[model samples]
Target: MASDAVTIQVPGPHGDRDIRVSSPSRVLWPEQGITKLQLAEYMIAVGDAFVLANGHRPVSLQRFSADIDGEAFFSKNPPKGAPDFIRSVPVVYPSGRSHAQLVIDEPAAAVWAVQMNTITFHPWASRAEDTDNPDQFRIDLDPQPETDFRDAVRIAVELRAVMAEAGLTAFIKTSGGRGVHVFAPIEPVHEFLEVRHAVIAAARELERRMPTEVTTSWWKEERGAKVFVDYNQANRDRTMAGAYSARPLALAPVSTPLEWSELSDADPRDFTVLTVPGRLQSVGDPWEHFADDPGDLSTLLQWWERDLGNGLGELPFPPDFPKMPGEPPRVQPSRAKKP
Candidate 1:
């Protein structure tokens, strides 16, 4: 019996590769009726842009067993039976453990990921060649319960200013949800901890300037109806959805990049898998020159030292992480035993 499968030609740096996608008619996005084959086509449509932004990095594949709403898990390492084209790189986790993580180098690799039921691509801020020192400083502006995308936009606007002050050019993107991600191409001279501190310093500065609108509170209860500067995303092994990656939301939205001028008017819902390829064709990639000029962290690190002088110390790390030096208690403020 012949299974319902199809082979598609995906062009890459080497040449065109014939990739087979099984279950081509299987629906991945139930609401939009987007099938597995459509997802593969979407990857091919935006292949160049997607590879440009996410390639050469250690990427974690967000895979689903069924449709997006069903059981899902992250595949960091190269899964069994992965093609020779798909490579893996060694990375160190927060717990001092090291493991091999997958790296997507070209368009064919991305399409292959889609064939594996991968919905979202979470690439590390660092490149595969140098996993210890991050070449990108990333910040996630997460909207709280009462806040929304508009609030995230407002924070992103100010965050652009903040990055500019630190001598870094900011790139903006939708998180495919209500949040926004701001990234700056940085020199890979500093390790993840230093970059994390730099992010914290900038986050604190932004909070000071927009006290009512922004907060760096790691604990959700402490953050009101304000946008949270997710400083921890700058840490090692931490990642947000890479640009042009499709999120597993009902609408099948991609983490579309945006120009600063276009962000104010952009709506995330409009940048779905069904529409993003056309958007890419129309306006081109906003982050086309993202890595052209890399910025240093001198200014931001100075701010971190100054904040330290003012008694502003370390914040909580992700619960799964080992207890870091100088990190505050992991317990919630309300749950802590008072002296």
Candidate 2:
């Protein structure tokens, strides 16, 4: 009984009516006492502080709280209404430094918005002169493409290892798609460009060690048998729609949540809008305190410099969009299209 018009019992968070979003215009979040129209209104509000500030877009809210792998992340000692999904509220961040403090009456909508877009946080890589969010970077994965869930997991784990060895902490999330995203928490000191290079260094090194398991190409065709570790995605000019909440997922499915350990062993089939809360409660959350985020880019760069050229010749590149000097056109869309 749900449609563009406000309806009920369509199946959501607490109950069918507990969570639901309308098509043309509406969002009913009974768990948080937020209505379809009201939520949409907030979307318009945050646009100023968030979107315009960072050149990012606002993702729509839904009736449900993202089923995050919390057993491992949120400590039980959090305040009474820390985030019990049913008892807590949802927050949205189109873009801007939120106090990160979650007040029950006015929880941070921006953070809640992550479930909707694939967000990247360059946490520590800051320069002494800058004053904006040091954790500024974009996310650019195939928002809607056929992919191997296993490879996505591999990408996250490998990134975690790379970051860990580099002396930085990176958290991973299921992009609510055929991919997973690894986020590094950095302090707000450096601008977008420096952070972007740090990410690039880390990514290139991973491609070197895991040659068959990963690809660092910006082009798709060149990424035939490996997970494309897209370094270009870290470009300051790019942005990732935050993951977890809801997005224009080529259709209408929302980006779901997962626990930390799950990355070692979990499938995309285990999650969906209707059947996630129960799992969330039973297992609690998996990534309660994923990794100790030290927020150091200098250390990461050191690791990168030492290991960059140690991989293969050079990773595969895309087609004639532009021919770099010595590199051959690595991708052949026409050849791949040939039967």
Candidate 3:
């Protein structure tokens, strides 16, 4: 370790390991006065839960060059000087290209990520071994303009009911912003496209039940004040903030897991890096049993087929993706209408 850096011992699958955190006094979250060492300690405090949610999965690191509010970029590939303990797995991207991405297998690896200046952890829905199939289906409840967290929360409640009808168990989490994320553990029987369709099915159903408050509109102009169900998040290589990952927002709020009962009264600002460690100690991880008894996506797929038969075909994928086979035009709705 350098004279300025601090070495902290972290426990992982391989037991205790010494990890050096450079620039321990450098402020990462400027508003909160959170230092680099404080972020590393936060990872250590929630290490087990963080690993349970993010480990053994290919992840992209959101690294900051200076402070959280400074220059930032995503590091999908392993940067130079990554330790032997840090591992990488090759995963296919939407462009038909393949490359190795970093995977955090234990708590110590996460601390190492903080040392690399990672503020948020973006883990894939699939495990590192089965990179082709997703065992988890994710839905991002993104609140559009004129909408807020409360709107997203209401849509999440409706989504939970939709999942229940399909025999799937749903888990809730904050998006570390003005949105929410809902996940359901599923057997790894379907590929990314199938999972994406399953998410679309769920989102369409929620929209049907609450047309005034929810929407699956591919174009932003049509979304209005509704919460946008970002089904595209299920696409291969796409990721969400890990359950216990910290966000680079003003308060350094964490993307936290929550029991259904707490959603109604929950305030996202309370779940920050400074407070989450103690919250985990007292309340325990709400997603401890999240992977138990993984459900099948058969019911959701059936819904997808039903929607197709009714004339709602494939929606537009992300613009960066190669134009998919049945996807609608990528043009914005207002512009597409122009002659």
Each model's Cα RMSD: 1.2, 12.2, 1.5
Which of the numbered candidates is closest to the native, going by highest lDDT? 1
> Residue by residue across 236-328, what tens digits does model 2's lDDT show?
223343332333232232344455666678665455333344454576443344323447678656555565556423333233223433344
Pairs of residues at least 3 apart in sequence or in different chains that clash in candidate 3: none
What TM-score, computed on C-alpha atoms, does each candidate reach? Answer: 0.98, 0.53, 0.98
Candidate 3: tens digits of C-alpha lDDT, residues 1-339: 123998999988788999998889999888899998999999999999999988898999999988887999999878888889999999999999999999998899999999999999999999999999999989999999999999999889989999999989999999999999999899998999999999999999999999999999978888898899998899998999989999999999999999999999999999999999999999999999999979998999999999999999999998889999999878987778766
lDDT of 1 by residue, 184-214 (tens): 9999999999999999999999999999999
| Candidate 1 runs further than 4 Å off | 1-3
When 1 and 2 are scored with lDDT, the better candidate is 1
* Minimal lDDT window, size 10, model 3: 1-10
Best model per TM-score: 1
- Residue-pair clash count for candidate 3: 0
Quote the lDDT for 329 in model 2.
44
Any runs in candidate 3 off by more than 4 Å, and if so which?
1-3, 337-339
lDDT for position 225 in model 1: 90
Question: What is the lDDT, from 0 to 100, of the residue 303 in candidate 2?
Answer: 56
lDDT of 3: 0.93
